[model samples]
Target: MADQTPNSDAYRRGMVTRRSVLGDAHVDRAQANTTSFDAPFQKLITEGAWGTVWSGDQFTKRERSIVTIALLAALGQDEEVAMHVRATVNTGATREDIREALMHVAIYAGVPAANHAIKIAKGVYAEMDQQAAAKDR
Candidate 1:
């Protein structure tokens, strides 16, 4: 096996998975925007959330994506909800699936939360669709 340092494997795996799910552009921008103050925060999420939970095989990425969308929506995390909604392309969660999940968010979390999430999700979907169309040309 190749030589590796402690935490290297997890960090490497996390970075790769994060890129795959979030896309290289988004991850690149995030890394570019990271400052000295928030560097540790970025590293923690990279190794912890992306490495451990996301890399796990218990639930397929699709299921995890749906759950994430719902939870983010419930929490009124508009930005995160939009980001995860974009991730649905890589995770195999469809627009309809997001809508269904938002319905649950409305019932359990509150209608206001779901309403705001829907707005964010719609904008993200529109932007993604535009990108896809541009690529096709």
Candidate 2:
């Protein structure tokens, strides 16, 4: 893997992580929307975020989920935070991770943003739990 160029490895790993984290339907929609204007940006993120960072051995997916949730919340990116909260289930992140990340967000981002993010996280978590419960039955 290290022998390959960053772009190639990144693209490959990004595709894997993108599908695993975002799901095929969401990734398919994003791929369908890709245009010449945004292609480079998409590639960059794929390589940087999925390929290099996510592929690292340092952190487990669960840890990454926590960090990502905290960062997104701190940035006040509610939509992205919500998406990541949804992704957490697949990444081995439990509801506790979301709560802890939100706590961090409150300290770093501000109370208002954290509060809103908490609401969004709770809603996403409720849906996730309901789905899990239904599947078990």
Candidate 3:
């Protein structure tokens, strides 16, 4: 945490929460790729998304993961949806939870958006399965 830049309480909490949700390897890669151009944007999400909202005690990580995936799907954030779908492993969001969220998306958002996100989720799950299988081998 000391190595993390921006000496703010929010940033510190954000880093911890973000790492817990996204995993150390993903966070490390993101941090490593940080540059002058996107530093501010990165900081904002860390503090706002992770530190403030995500750190709140109101919602469990699993609930948050489901809502996040649905919102990203509605917004057509393909990459974000895929990333969050993968994060479900850490967040304790089961495939059943995600499926229900996408069902909600299909009704409230659009069938096409939910359809695309479902495709993305299936691909991510398959990829995760492959990784797990590799680990067991």
Candidate 4:
């Protein structure tokens, strides 16, 4: 049987961490889209990925960002890769980190996958940078 000891504290911490890393708008949209069909899956990810894994002290958000980017690229998950690219700024992962991870993806995941991921990342990054610049000006 799955252990169901109420991990309220862990869940709270995970929510905070998830919001900080993914941003409030993204998180809110995800929550708004939750349905009977996907609610369980969403809860599972919140508890497992966010609460258990992401809440651990084993890796900084920056390190997690690098790993996530590479995995998404290798899996050909271009949409997820683009989302993470935008989240990188909040995770303290610079554009250099994205570049390095994409370079690794080129060798391991193949040039095609890396090329597509890089293009998506570049577009996301450019939009984010433009938004930041606009705010500053």
- TM-scores for all candidates? 0.89, 0.86, 0.96, 0.90
The best-first sequence of candidates by lDDT reads 3, 1, 4, 2
47-97: candidate 2 lDDT, tens digit per residue:
889888877889998999899989888888989988999888678988887
Task: Tally clashes: model 2.
Answer: 0
* Residue range with the least summed lDDT across 10 consecutive positions in model 2: 1-10
Off by over 4 Å in 4: 1-7
Candidate 3 lDDT by residue in tens digits, 56-83? 8999999999999999999999999999
TM-score of 4: 0.90
lDDT for 11 in candidate 1 is: 84
Best by TM-score: 3
Candidate 4: Cα lDDT at 119: 94
Clashing pairs in 4: none
Tell me model 4's lDDT, rounded to 2 decimals: 0.85
Model 1: per-residue Cα lDDT at residue 35? 75
Candidate 1, residue 115: lDDT: 96
Residue pairs of candidate 2 with colliding backbone atoms:
none
User: Alpha-carbon error at 71 in model 4, in Å?
Assistant: 0.4
